[model samples]
Target: MKVAIYTLGCKVNQYETQAMEQELRRRGHQVVAFEEAADVYVVNSCSVTAVSDRKSRQMLYRVRREHPQAVLALCGCYSQTHPEDVEKLDVDLIAGTGDRSGFLDLLEQAAAERRHIVALDRSFDHRTFEVLPAGGLESRTRCLLKVEDGCVNFCSYCIIPYARGPVRSLPLDKAAEQAAGLKAAGYREIVLTGIEISSWGQDLKDGKSLIDLLETVAAAAPGVRLRLGSLEPRTVTEDFCRRAAALPDLCPQFHLSLQSGCDETLRRMNRKYDTARYLQSVELLNRFFDRPAVTTDLITGFPEETEAEFEQTLAFIRACGFARMHIFPYSIRPGTPAAKMRQVPKSVKEERAHRAAAVAAELRKNYLEGCVGATYPVLFEQPKEDWFFGHAPNYAEVLVKGTDLHNEIRPVTITSTDGEFLYGTIKE
Candidate 1:
């Protein structure tokens, strides 16, 4: 069977899609592009926002329309939260957030019998981690290793906790082994990803934390650069920063999840930390690492977010001066508490999003300019149009004109800035 996978949303979803493709290939099935007609079309969907939900449905309809005879399967957050919704799309096989292995089996069976199959369980009932393959689609410089799954944090605006479950971590040894495998496979960088990585060690009875797993993976794959996915602010303590800073291979970029910057808004959204604590986390990282790039996500126009509150957020963000930021206008998810709250008008949301983005743009411009005249070690990933693009240790996208620099670490002298990216030259 030839399979084409269309994946949407977070790094974790991308990791799972890659795993599914690997399984299909291992089972002697050909994995092809989604545009090409194939025996099966797997849409690993996202439900982060209404837009994501619509995109999932849109992809399902288009794929089914394009390849009328092909078997269509839908999985991930959108399908997990609403399997009935996916079933209505006339998919041949349907599974939720869990059990990728079983999903593949059912997909095979569905293809063999030409039957529709729906397999979804209560996401909250899931307690065990579903281990999937740890690498990427491209056999290249960087890969992702998902060491955790699920989120217990019931943020007022999020549907992920319901879609995914409580925290389930990959055992320390298993994480180490996966890192070793990725290193052995010639991957130069490994991004530790999950639904909520900060809650990694909560389910464990033994004394273990993300730092412990980080130490194990760092030692296991000394040659590979270790970067982390979005992290909760509470994880960056003095002790955590000190230990993590000692790891030579760990990348200095820290993506702290900051949904809102106003204290009142944070309370309304049920965020675990306030802007003060979040700033402390930012400070800790900067104090520990040399010019660590602090990045974050900010949501604008929550219910009851007054213009004054929005101003506070903009002020707070400017204070932090994030190197990169993902700013979104709050989208109401039907099942979440935020949906039923007093709504902000869409026009207000858009206005605030633009306001927040302006601050973000200014911060990004300053951050990029700050890199000028500095030297950075970049792991070259791919060469395009006579320019090689890679990332600095702080996770800044660095583009330099070079030849044959693939998978090699080279110091690049930063010469120019493009607001969000740095243009540099390989030091002779």
Candidate 2:
């Protein structure tokens, strides 16, 4: 069978799609491109917001309309949370967030019998983590190791907790083993990713936290660079900073989730921490690592967010001086609490997003300028035009005028920046 998968949303979704592709290939099925003809088409969808949900629906509808004869399967967050909507699409097979292997079995069955199959369990009833193989198909430079799954944090603006259930973590030993395997497979970097990586050890009851898992994986893969996914601000404590700083191979880039920087907006959003605590996380990272890149996510014009509140958020983000930021205008998710609250006007949301983006751009320029004189070990990934591109430990994209540098880590001395990429020369 020829199977093609189209993934949408976060890195976790991309990782899951890769795992599915590997499984299909392992079963002697040919995995084709989504554009090409195939026996099966999978839409690993996302529903982070209404926009995300719309995209998922559009993709599914297009696939069904284009290839009416092929078996169409739906999985991931969108289908997990809104199965009724998905069922209306007449998809051949529908699987939720869990049970990848079983989902494949149903896919095969659906293809063979040409029957509609819906295999979805109550997400909250799941207690164990569904472990899947890590690594990408063609890319050897970097791979994602999903150390945890599910989210218990029921923020007012989020529906992930309902879609993903409570926190279920991959065992420490299993994570280490996987890290070692990825290292042996010649991967230059291994990223620790999850639905909520900061909540990694909550279900284990072993008292081992994310720092412990980091230590174990670092030990297993001595030379592989270990990068982390988005973390909760509360996860960054004095002890965590100290322990994480001790890991020689850990990437010095921390992405702390800060949806809004205003206290009142944060309270309305049901965020666990305020701007002060988020700033402390940034400060702690700066204290422990030399010029560590601190990145974040911000949502503007959330429900009932006043202009003063938006200004406060801008001021707070300026104070924190993020190395990079992903700014989004607030979008309503039907099932989330924020959707029912007094909503901000769409125009206001977009305007606030634009203003926040301007501030973010300024901060990014400042951060990039600060990287002018430093030297870093850059792991080269690909070539473009006359330059080979890669990323530093701080996750700064670096370019050098060179060839044959793919998958090679070399000492690069920063010479300049065009407010976008750091241009450097490789030191022999």
Candidate 3:
């Protein structure tokens, strides 16, 4: 069978899609591109926002229309949260966030019988983490190791908590074992990703935390560069920072989630931390690591967000000086609490997003300028035009003029920046 998968949303979705692809290939099925003809088409959907849900529907509709004869499957957050909507589509098989292996089994069964199958379980009933393969295809230099799944943080703007349920973590030993395997497989970097990595070990009842898991994985993969996914600001304490800083192979880049920097907006959003706590996390990372790249997410024009509140957010981001930022205009997600609140005008939302983006651009430029003249060991990934491109430990994209530098970690002395990427030369 020829199976093609189209993934949407966050890195966890990407990781799950890769795992499914590997499983299909292992079963002697050919995995094809979404644009190509196939016997089965899987749309791993995302419902983080209404726009994300729309895109998932668009992809599913497109695949169904283009390939009328193929078996269409819908899974992930969108289907998990809104199965009724997904059922209206011409999909042949439907599975929620859990049980990818079983979903594939149903796919085979549906293909054989030409029948419709729906397999979904209550999200809250889930207690164990679904362990999948850790790496991508052999050609990739970096792979993601999902150390945890699910979220209990029911922020007012999020639908993920309901879609993903409570935290269920991959055991420490299993994570270490996977890290060792990924290292042996010649992966240059292994990223620790999840729905909420900060909540790892909560379900284990072992009194261990994310830092413990990090130390274990670092020991398991001595030479592999370890990168982390988006973290809750509360996770960055003195103990966490100190232990994490001790890991020699850990990348000095942290992505702390900060939706709004204003205290009142944060209160309405039900965020666990305020601007002061978020700033402390940034400061702690900077103090522990040498100019560590601190990245964040910002939502502009949230429901009832006053102009003064937006200004406060801008000021707060400037104070933190993020290395990079993902700024979004607030979009109403139907099931989320923020959707029911007094809404901001769409024009105002977009305008605020533009302003926030301008600030983000300035901060990024400043951070990049600060990188000049510093030397970093860059892990080369691919070549473009006349240069091989890779990322430093700080996750800065660095380009050096070379050929066949893929998968090689070479010390690169930064010479300049074109305001977007760092141009450097290999320190032979």
Candidate 4:
């Protein structure tokens, strides 16, 4: 059968979709793009916000309309949260966030019977981690390895905890084995991704933490660089940074999750850490790893966020000097606490997002400037037109004009900047 998979939202979702594609291919199915004619269409979706929900529905409807004869499959966070919403689309198969192996089986059954199938289990009943083989179809420079799944953090603004269910971890031995396998598959880098990596090991009765998992994976793939996904700020500490810095393969980029920078807004959002603690985490990472790229995500104009609070957030971001930042105007997710609270005007949210974005752009420019005249070991991913694109150990995208640089790690002399990316030449 020819299959087309459409992935929406988060690296974890992407990783799952990649796993699904691998499984389908192992069963002798040809995987292609959604627009191309195919026997099946899989829409792996998200419900992080109402907008995300809308997008998921739109994608499902479009796929159904375009290929009316093809079997339509819907799964992931959106389906997990609202199975009925997805079923309303007249999809052939509906599987929730869990049970990938079972989902694939159901897809096969749908193909055999040519009928609708809905396979959804109570998300909170989920306890076991569904392990899937890592790596993409084509040999790529970077592969994502999901070390953990589900979130226990009930942040007031998030619906993920409900959609993802209780924390479930991949055993340390399995993670090590997957890392070795991915490295052997010719991946130059492995991004340790998850829905909430910080909550890793909580499911285990044995006292293990993310640091322990990182130690094992890093040791397993000493030759391949290991990058991390977004982390809870509260997880970073002097001890954590000290141990993580000792790992030679760990990338020097850290993305801490900071929804709001003001203590009052954080309180409203029910974030685990305050602005001061988040700053401490940033400081600790910088102190341990020389010139590490500290990145973060910020939500501007949260419910009832005053002008004074927004200024505090901008000031806080400027103080941190993030190498990269993703700024978003907070979107109200239905059923979340903040949704029913006093909502910020759309104009105010947009204004605050612009203000935060300007500061972030300035800081990023300065960070790139700091890379000038420095030599970095970059893992070349692919070549585009006249320039070859790759990432520094700090995960900064490095562009250089050269030929035959794919999958090679070489020292590149940073010489110029194109405002966003650093342009350099590989030192022969």
lDDT of 1: 0.91
TM-score of 1: 0.98
Candidate 1 per-residue lDDT, tens place, 324-391, comes to 89988889888889999999999999999998898899998998899999999899988868689999
- Write down the RMSD of candidate 1 (Cα, Å): 1.1
lDDT of 4 by residue, 133-250 (tens): 8998655889999988999888889999889999999999999999999888888899999999998999997999999999999999888999989999989989899999999888
Residue-by-residue lDDT tens digits, candidate 3, 337-392: 89999999999999999999999999999999999999999999999888899999
- Could you give candidate 2's per-residue lDDT for residues 315-427 as a string of tens digits? 99999999999999998889988999998999999999999999999999999999998899999999988999999999999999999998999999999998889999999
Runs off by more than 4 Å, candidate 1: none
Q: After best superposition, candidate 4 residue 281: deviation in angstroms?
A: 0.7
Q: What is the TM-score of each candidate against the true structure?
A: 0.98, 0.99, 0.99, 0.98
Candidate 3 residue 200 C-alpha distance from true site, Å: 0.2
lDDT of 2: 0.93
* Candidate 1 lDDT trough over 10 residues, lowest sum: 131-140
Model 3: residue 309 alpha-carbon error in angstroms:
0.6
Give lDDT per model, in order. Answer: 0.91, 0.93, 0.93, 0.91
lDDT of the structure predicted as candidate 3: 0.93
